[model samples]
Target chain A: MSAPSQDLLARMALTFEAQQFLYAEARLLDTQNYKAWLELVTDDIHYWAPVVESRERRHRAGHYVAAADESAYFDDTRATLGMRVARLGFPGAWAEVPPSRMTRLISNVEVGEQGAEDIPVRSCFYLFRSRLETEEDSYHGVREDVLRRVDGELRLARRKIIFAQSVLTARSITTFL
Target chain B: MTFDVSRLVDLENGLIDRRIFSDAEIYDAEMDRIFRRTWLALGHESEIAETNDFFTTWMGADPVIVSRTAQGIKVMLNMCRHRGGTVCRVDRGNAKLFLCPYHGWSYNPDGTLKVVPGLEADYRHGIDPTQWGLLEAPRVATYKGLIFASWNPEVEPLEEFLGDARFYLDCLLDRVEGGTELVGGMRRWIIPTNWKHAAENFVGDSYHAAATHASIMRVPGLEGAGGRVKDVVGYQAALDNGHGVGMWMASEDNARGGYGHLAGIDDYLKSIQDQLVAKLGELRATRLTPVHATIFPNFSIEFPFASLHIWHPRGPLKTEVRDLTIVDKAMPAEMKDMLRRHCMLRQGPAGTWEQDDMDNWSQTTYSSLSPTARGLMANYQMGMGHEHTRDDIPGRIDNKSSDINQRNMYARWAELMAMDPPPPQVPAACRSHSGEISR
Candidate 1:
């Protein structure tokens, strides 16, 4: 790979900014400031966690946690995500009453080709998570992001996280990864 | 030190000595006599149908790689013999040899140590590579596509170990054509509660459906789906070797009524019912319904929902549960998608029902550790004296969702705990003086 062009660097700055945006988002999540966090994404963004299986000899199989054919953990449109965020804010979301603390570290930033005015970026992320009043839990994975520069600001058009641990250690992923 | 056998076997009343749950001594005995001795479900054979296919999972905290070889599916310890490093670290992938990241020592898919990083000249044949592959789990066997492994080499064959459970499983597994293929991948999560809670919950606790998942019934489409929208009916049947099955019938009159009535369920049964009836005949298909049951101790199959094989490892003050859910392979792409969606919504980390269950389970463990709350008995008395022994079946049977299943589980736990040497006892002062703990 040759050195990234200045224009690409300028474009990549949004990717870097997107990384920062994601970092700030993680902080909001860790602190359980979900209402403030909800403003960061577009109304149409899709959040997903795909489940993979290790078939003997075949290596990795199956995609999507439930399965792509099946419903998703949160196959939310912006509206559904909003509703979920609202639900989390309620006092009765017992799973989050104590609230889970999360720290998402995004690194290894690499910019890929631009598609229809949007640049695709890939980065490695390690999430150090802990829930209050419980055992320490964490998740690490790689993030593939598609960023759209909207009105001079980078917004996450799409974000897909492929986690390394097939099985989660947390009591429940009540909060977003 | 040995457990007080007399006190542990109080079957009349469901009171188990509080010592059973928190005692390190009892836990260690269980590891040997129960976890090690039983035919523990490893992974589905469908996972390793082809040579070199492999899946990494834990069999009672022992990391195991279930792989397919020329001979067939085999379960081997994930730890390399050269060093204790995990031979295959990636959750699942294909490779003819498992190369250790530490020293670059490699082993064939068959688990034969094949290469030593510096062995060409450094060792001069001093190390016997043939004997240094991953250690084989003592006993590995399969019933239908469900593969099981045992640490004890002398454990009985999977068929004999399954015994009467086979009758139910055959109906569950063989009834479907081409058997079942795991759809999507297994939804894995860690729960803070003991594994027994999960086993018993799925085994026969249909009574909790109306309450624990009352919200699900309100999900619009599912309200009148299976006639299961309202009152829950419980049916329990205990199989041999402590395995059991339970049906939360739609109603008492229609014990197996509305078997194929639920939205996702009716579709699922329609897709496979004919093939299953063709393969296993009507007798078996008619007897089974959309139900969930355990293959003793750890493995559980939830028909029309998900199939979970669990591994519960007890730490000093904590417990970790690993669950795997499987789906059918032949269903339409759209239906499969719906099934996966339903499962994720209901059971995964973000699942609605799972969220509540995890909270309860975690709180159970957390509260059980309180010094002031210690010894508070956790009640399992949902339905008492409702259990009866059937002449044809191997274990007990009950009319409704009763603690009979939980009692059966504890009964097995007590049995396993008794089979091995007990751990050193703690002083009287350390013991909780409280009567019983409640969740």
Candidate 2:
């Protein structure tokens, strides 16, 4: 076997860090520790999940994927995200009154576009949620995120989710992906 | 097929049978009696503006393709005539021909059978192409840019069916001179609730907001924002043909809060105030703004966010809520963006207010499944005799919190379910261009 190169070792180290960060973040979400999870994102975080549609490959130019100004599932800023988290603590939040049991399985962590201050990361997630006895839902999607260094700590600057299903089978997307 | 609706719906005292939401027999009857006879909204005209542009959807459980041919908009069954395979599987596309991948059965945009593979060699041209085209709906119509279709050829005209509801629909569709268009593609999700639960909710169920959406009020931007304009009383209109609308009397108070609690929509409406008044008059444009309405059967409109809902019935216990956001074509890009964001914040599968609604509606449906629950009557007697006719308003006017609209809708459902279904029409392929079937 050939000697290991310095660049390959650096890429492997970055991948391990990204996987660890993602696993910790998923644990926070699973534990319903939204306040702690919020700390992992930058103040100017752009969290969005565009509507995925089924269209022919020939008409894939602008129709297959949702446009910037088109319909989206979660188009949130930090403040808006905070409002959602705040609602979880309210008494009348019936959707989460009983609280959904959720487990997020994150895998396929790959690094892309490594920059000095920001790095783009891609991963696949399988979110399983069970609520109120027999109601169960599984959400399979891929998340594209931009991780930036804020005060020497890794923080999520942007996240865009692309779901695999054209029609959302889950009743509500209460948990973060 | 006739249903004994007498025991199920008792409109005299505003009592509805709980079985209507959980019964398989009633659900099957709805497909024949209601969905077949009534006009079902498919999509907006702008969705398939160009020739040959197409969008696929469902009419009841049946898959359909709504396409625009050079002649006009054509809606046909998406199934191939040869086999039961879907011809056009995608959601939206621009295709002049829909070729079935099963055995290469191709169809024109107008649903006429175009070509069949191995026609000369395999079948020796024995099959007639005209008599084997895709099955098309009997009646298709459009009111304002919304396209609707019905399977009954003897169904009433769309305008007559819409009746006085047009006045309210125009408030949302024709507010500006340029008219409205759907901003982008639709957002859809499945809810484990009866379709009527969703339909009746939009049919002036203003009472559900306080309890069902209590958490939404705590949100900063959505605080105290909904169909009702702040400080202004709203009225629920139970129109003819089961259509219902809940609207607030347009007032100066609208300038402060009503536009779904968004910050800039009030100022944007002010900018186009004159244009709106000129187009819709003072009554529609200024004095009356319908917030949410259901046009019978399953189509619904929410004006605050300029979104439309099609509660496509999946079964007795499931509903596929398909939503499309609309905006005036004359509005600037910024206003459109604001409305789009507002819709996302409040109404899709992940909507803040809508999330709670799903929980309530699903639980409501789940409880109704018990035999004891189904035997009990679901009370709808909030404001029974209090419903009075209004000279200014065009329908039976009731208080915003009343169940008058729900009673009216059930009355209409019973009337439809009691009637004998129309005779089945000849197949589209076997019919002539003038719609006369020839042997």
User: By DockQ, who's the top model here?
Assistant: 2
Worst 10 residues of 1 chain B by lDDT: B430-439
Give candidate 2 misplaced runs (Cα > 4 Å): A1-3, A61-63, B1-3, B224-230, B250-260, B428-439
Best by TM-score: 2
Worst lDDT window (10 residues) for model 1 chain A?
A: A57-66
B1-439 per-residue lDDT for model 2 (tens digits)? 3446898899887788888888888888788778877889898999999999999998877789998998898889898989768999899989979999999999999999999999999999888888888888989999889999988899999999999999889877887777888988778889999999999999989999988888877778755344435566789999999999998875565543445466677778778888878887766666676888999999998888788999999999999989899998988999899889888878888888788888888988888889888878899998888989887778999998999898888889899989865555656444347543211
The sequence of per-residue lDDT tens digits that candidate 1 reaches over residues B1-439 is: 5667447546667665544555566566566567767888876776676789887877765677888899777788787676568888766656799888888888899888888877868887877666566777757877777788887776778788888776666655676656666654566667777666677777777776666555545443322232233355546876666677875434334333344434556556656667767775554443434366787777776665564657466553345554455655556666656655555555667775567667766666556567655555567776687768855334578865677777777777677766652221212333235421100
DockQ of candidates 1 onward, in order? 0.33, 0.82
Tell me how far the alpha carbon of residue B93 in candidate 2 is from the true structure, in angstroms, after superposition.
Answer: 0.4
- Report model 2's chain A TM-score: 0.95
Interface RMSD of 2: 0.9
